[model samples]
Target chain A: MIRADETESTIVPRIEVGERLEAGFEWFEDTFDSAINWVGSTVAYISDGLAEILAIPDALILTVILAAIAWLVRNWKLALGTVGLMLFIITVDQWNEALETLALVAVAAAIALIIAIPLGVLAAKSQIASRIIRPVMDLMQTMPALVWLIPALAMFSLGMTAGIFATLIFALPPGVRFTELAIRQVDAEVVEAGHAFGSTPAQILFRVQLPLAAKTIMAGVNQVIMLALSMAVFAGFVGAGGLGTEVVRAISQLNLALGFDAGLSVVMLAIYLDRVTAGIGGGEGVLAKLLRRRKSAPVQTEETAEDKAATGSPTT
Target chain B: MTDTASNNVAPAVSVQNAYKAFGRRPQTIVKRLKEGATRDELKSQGMAAVIDASFDVAPGEIFVVMGLSGSGKSTLIRTLNGIQPPTDGTVKIFGQDITNVSPRQLRSIRREKIAMVFQHFALMPHRTVGQNAAYALEVRGISRSDREKKAEEALNMVGLAGYGGSFPHELSGGMRQRVGLARALAAETDLMLMDEAFSALDPLIRKEMQDQLLELQQQLGKTIVFITHDLNEAMRLGNRIAMMRDGRIVQIGTTEQILNDPANDYVAQFIQEVDRTRVLTAGEIMEPPVAVLGAGQGPRAAHRLMREHQTSALCVVDQTRHLQGVVYEDDVAAAVAAGAEGLTGLLRQMPATLPGTLLAELIGAASQHAAGLAVVDDHGRLHGVIPRVTLLNALADTSAEGAVRTILEEAPA
Candidate 1:
């Protein structure tokens, strides 16, 4: 290896790529100032509305409702676990911040899905659309979640709106990708059957494709929500309030106690949301299975009786 | 149903010079084909799924298109329903040219007039059997109660009456196919396209389904175009069978016509693999009785007729051609020697077979008696007779030489 001081040789000239990118961002901000502001306000309104609604219910009452939902959708075990997690958050005095975080994730994931699903459907239905959307989704997903906060902060300033904006971009790719994959993976023969019966393209998409793709799409929803939750923590750098703010505060002050409490709360929330969403996606949870069995009991008996009668006859 | 008026009625389905090529630019492939390019020459451009196919299916007739996989039979059936439009030529459903119809118009035609059954029982997994059966009507925007009622009736027709509430995955493969059949039946369309509908079922279940379909056809008289690779299935179900090879239909005819007089070597070889005993009917193989003695004639006349025909037995029929019985040579001689005046006393009961009875069922009865079995119609009128020799000959004649000779005899000069 040659010493740097021994020779002066330049193999390649330095490029102004970073300057051009910065200029591009400035130009975009300048050109779309009003549009960006309008979007920011809209996002702020949604997040604020959700946060207010979450705040209205007493924490205990909300916890009980959520636990009940968990029981109905999953099992008693998950419900009990949710109760324990909620109590822990309350005990640590992080309940309000946890709720704010929940509201932020809900808003981000909802907005992301509303846009992603249709784009996914369009991509799945048309080859040209798929080719165009795939690379963009790749770029969105592969780019660091922290990178999105830069543009978001520039557009919305330091607020919940900027946090939601970053989280929405961070969470959107899986929603679009999984939706497109799920729709495309639907049985071709089934789709053909739909067409054979003279169903319109819209009817087939709604009736056949969507129903079959429901479970997979639900998995995508889970991924979006989880991603939004993770990205919301990083949004604390922009002064977005929530558990993320506490986390930022603990990090800056080197308060280990605050860090542990906020981290535990995030983990608990993640686990609760993940299990509930997964149970919904998998379908036929313990309670659901029991209910379905009870409902179909009479039909099952009738089917067996008919089967016996069929076997008894020699005509076959 | 009069023969003369039948000519004026439009065929339920018609394809004239229809060709389907699979690729982005199917029209160019079709153009090359019409310009006398062979399938191999155009292989690089696209796959020619169907080439110059033409046929007509009459109302209430089962027209089967038979071919192995990749022979374009599936593609051909799809064209009838406009699932895959032909690259060239015309397709007509009930005399309405579908080739040029707008997509909306074609869809309405499928909704109102046509139904299809898939080989794989492409039923919606999420839907219950009843819901799956009701799907066609549902797509047509029929009321839920009305479509459900129709679906229930169709389910009953296929012997799946009470299983409508069950999901498809819960049912056996055969039962799932019943749901598929019920779906089509509920549509109540005059035309049905069955793309190897029973191909996925167990052999026993397939036979049962075939029987039920024939029984239903007897009552409903729906015009059907059935696609299958099995020659036996084609022979059993088709009123007219079209045999395809390499995207081209080589022959189209009734079962007997195709069996006894194949159009080409490929068809000849195809029929050779079919179990002749099961496919050939009594009427198809039976010959005219050697000689018939009128029931009013004397024993002497019966003996004389037997002698004149050089036969061991003779069929005795009334003036209306109703079969009385058979008078063997020995019985007639004994009656004549005993001075019997009429042939009735000497007539012996003989086993009779219906014209539609399969030869496999007649082999045991035909072998025990040397005189042969009498072939009769529903009215017990004598149609023909099947001698033991003819039965044996028919079964053994599936040899390559015999098949070649038959093909040669049927070939045009």
Candidate 2:
């Protein structure tokens, strides 16, 4: 067999992008030490504050408050279901870890929304900004959840703060994408009507576009919550304490019952959080319809574009 | 123009050489970098929607811009309130040049001076009818109580009372349009732009709405710029109608002038299918009666008046020119020959027509009566006469001269 020439069959060309990134990161760490320190401390302060508040509350008391909120925001059935899930976590002896995870997810998602929504609005306002952001978001969403922990650990130091920072990056794309979509989906005619009546640009955005897009933005918020929950367990490897750490401990000791109970508690908590958020998001739509019924209802059950056309618009 | 000036009031709206092009405006730097880019070269890059449209609308006048789709009529109307700014030229509303105003000033103008009623109503789906009507007032930062009171008053004005609590989705098509009208009324702007505002309703309802608008115009005296593709509607509502074609105003004149003297073949073709009866008022088609024989005039004078007016009959009127009856040429000649000084025997009974009577309603009376119909105003004063030939020509869709000659020959004239 003839040997291929050295230049001919090199399967892939070597690119020094990874090496450049590593060198850049090293340079950043050396030069931006004070900035990094400030950010890391801020993250620590917020995460610690949240964790302390969550941990101080008695499990039963916290559960009752959460259940009450669910009942008020949604309905009684969702409230009872939440109570059951909280009791299950307490019985499994994982209530403390569950609360810790809840604090981490809450802080992460809140930061993500605060940052993401405005960024999405900016992106939606400008095509060039949107073009630049879309690819970066795709990369963030597609990268393995664990891959983010490496940089996050280096930047913030390994702790719950680092875990939240990682979760924030992981969950941010959905919030941004949905917010941009919601703003763009507001009817152009409605916006024009607002302008025709002499509404300022800010007024149009706040009074018209924001209200019309509320349901869609809520859906985005729900997505962020779900993503944060999913990332919490993966964050445990970097010393982020939660049910994730408990599962990791069980795995190392090969204690089957402890791992099973811990995993079951995570599942219960995830299910409960998901249902409550979904109810809050979706229940308003049904409730609004029910309220409309008490007043004079539309001729059609659904006011579709076709139905509007059927009424014979003057534009015809 | 001088008549309006003498009254010390400017036209409600004045547009001068307004041109609008649709497409990305070429970058200024790009144009500078390129050598010798001609107007044609630049124009090729963008579609021109309006071309040098100029008109003046007097105060309290319903000026209509009439055209089919793609004729730039809608674009021209939108340019009035700075919704779509003209590429070149000026639009002044009550003598204030809106084109050069800052955004803040434009907003003030929109809020305080101009109101628009859309074809689709453009009512806010989430708001109650009253709230939708008050939207313009709310934007102007009026107090809520005042806005609500004004909105209710407007709804009542448009005959949409008791609909304040209902949403747009819950209302019928006609009611929704009424709400749209009420919204504009609530704005209380002196200038209103109605873009195909009544075209959406059923035919019967559309007629009713048109009548309502005319009634409102009498009460409010708003200077309205009405847009429509329907020539009949343009004829009915417009104090002066502007005909647009391919982004240019082909002609602007009164309904009678447009119907009798079309500017070109395009305008002629546009008005061809329009039902003349529906469009022509009796006042428009009526002519000076063959003769108005005063009650004091003898049969000889009646015969002389008939000959002078080139008619075979004469109308007998009182001293106030109020129409009493008509006398045929033969009867007048016979009365004169029989030496009868009193004209009672010469007077013939005939149907009387009103100045507001449509040419359609006068056609039958004109064709059946030998002496034709007398056109009178509400006070019974003789406005003019609608003879058989004149009524026939108005009703006919053929060439005007040919129709009159054919009718005159076909009749006993």
lDDT string, candidate 1, B1-413, tens digits: 11211465678888999999998899999999999999989898889999999988888898999999999999999999889999999999999999999889988999999999999999998777777988999999997777777887898899887776667898999989989999999999999999999999888999899888888998999998999999998888888899999999999888877888889989988887999888778877899876898888998887777777789898889999999888888887888889989876677887899976888999999878878899999899999999899998877745466444456878899
For model 1 chain A, give the 10-residue run with minimal summed lDDT: A307-316
Chain B TM-score of candidate 2 stands at 0.86
DockQ, per model, reads: 0.33, 0.21
> Residues B55-94, candidate 2, lDDT per residue (tens digit)?
8988998999999998889889989988888887799999
Supply every candidate's count of residue pairs whose N, Cα or C atoms clash at under 3 angstroms.
0, 0
Best by DockQ: 1
Error of 2 at A179 (Å): 2.3
lDDT of 1 by residue, A89-111 (tens): 99999999999899999989999
> What CAPRI grade goes to candidate 1?
acceptable
* Model 2: residue B13 alpha-carbon error in angstroms: 1.9
Model 2 chain B: ten consecutive residues of lowest lDDT? B26-35
The 10-residue segment with the lowest total lDDT in model 2 chain A: A307-316
> DockQ for model 1?
0.33
Give the TM-scores of the predictions, in the order they appear: 0.91, 0.82
